[model samples]
Target: MSIKRPRTGGAWSWHQDYGYWYQNGCLYPDMASAFIAIDPNTKANGCMQVLRGSHKMGRIEHGRFGDQTGADPERVEPAARVMDLVYVELEPGDTLFFHSNTLHCSDQNTSESPRWSLLCCYNTKHNNPYKESHHPFYEPLEKLPDSAIKEMGSKLFEAKTDFWDPANDETVGTGKDQ
Candidate 1:
């Protein structure tokens, strides 16, 4: 999940999802993500940007960038010269799916409207990590009925799940919590 508050949101540096997953010991690049817009996404609100067809370029080197891991600028700058930079603007309920190696980032939200999106990531069983990592290995997904979702959205429903906090995570990448 990604969220950027109005006017005070921070920028996400250029990087590929594979760049981070590679560190987790995943053997293959068989992974992808679907970003579902929860609120209106526009350029003024710092919509996601991608280097079109960048997944073909393979994974780039990544290093710690403040509280996140980012692709090396030396490699990214040259790729940007050949690839098209596309700003992904979408309405609520819109979804954008991309390969793990796709280069992408988003700027700070300087507009009055908030920008929020939910990212559902997937990893193939063949791509499971050789060693244990922060993310889990191949686990069966539990399917819930449509009625379950309807009940969860109702005011009478009480939330039962706890959100994952990155602050408590002690990964080797960025020492500071975002």
Candidate 2:
């Protein structure tokens, strides 16, 4: 889940989900993510930007971009030059699914409305990591009904749950938790 506050959101450097997951020991590119728009996604609001068909290029080396781990510009620059750069504009409730290797990023929101989204990431059993880190190994998925969302809508995340904060993280650059 991500929340880009109106006019104050920060930019996300170009990156691939697999770039991060690979560090977690995932052996294959059998992963993906579903991005659901909770608020309107527009150009002015910093909608998601994707390099079309870039997933076919396979995984690229990743390194530090400010406090975040991002795709190395050496690769991203060339790919962006030849590929179609698509701005993913979506209305509320719209969902966009993409492969883990797809290069993507977003700019800071300059609109008055907030840009919020729910990101659901998935990993296949065949590509389970060799070692455990912050992410879990393969486990049986508990199917839930659509009504589950409304049922848990009012619930809040527990404060003690050790949420991952990239800004304070010291190991994302090294691909291991310290």
lDDT of 2 by residue, 21-111 (tens): 8888898999999999999999999999999999999999998866668999999999999999999999999999999999999988889
State the RMSD for candidate 2.
5.6
lDDT (C-alpha, whole model) for all candidates: 0.85, 0.87
lDDT of 1: 0.85
Q: Return the lDDT, model 2, position 97.
A: 98
C-alpha TM-scores of all predictions: 0.82, 0.81
lDDT of residue 18 for candidate 2: 93
Model 2 TM-score, 2 decimals: 0.81
Clashes of each: 0, 0
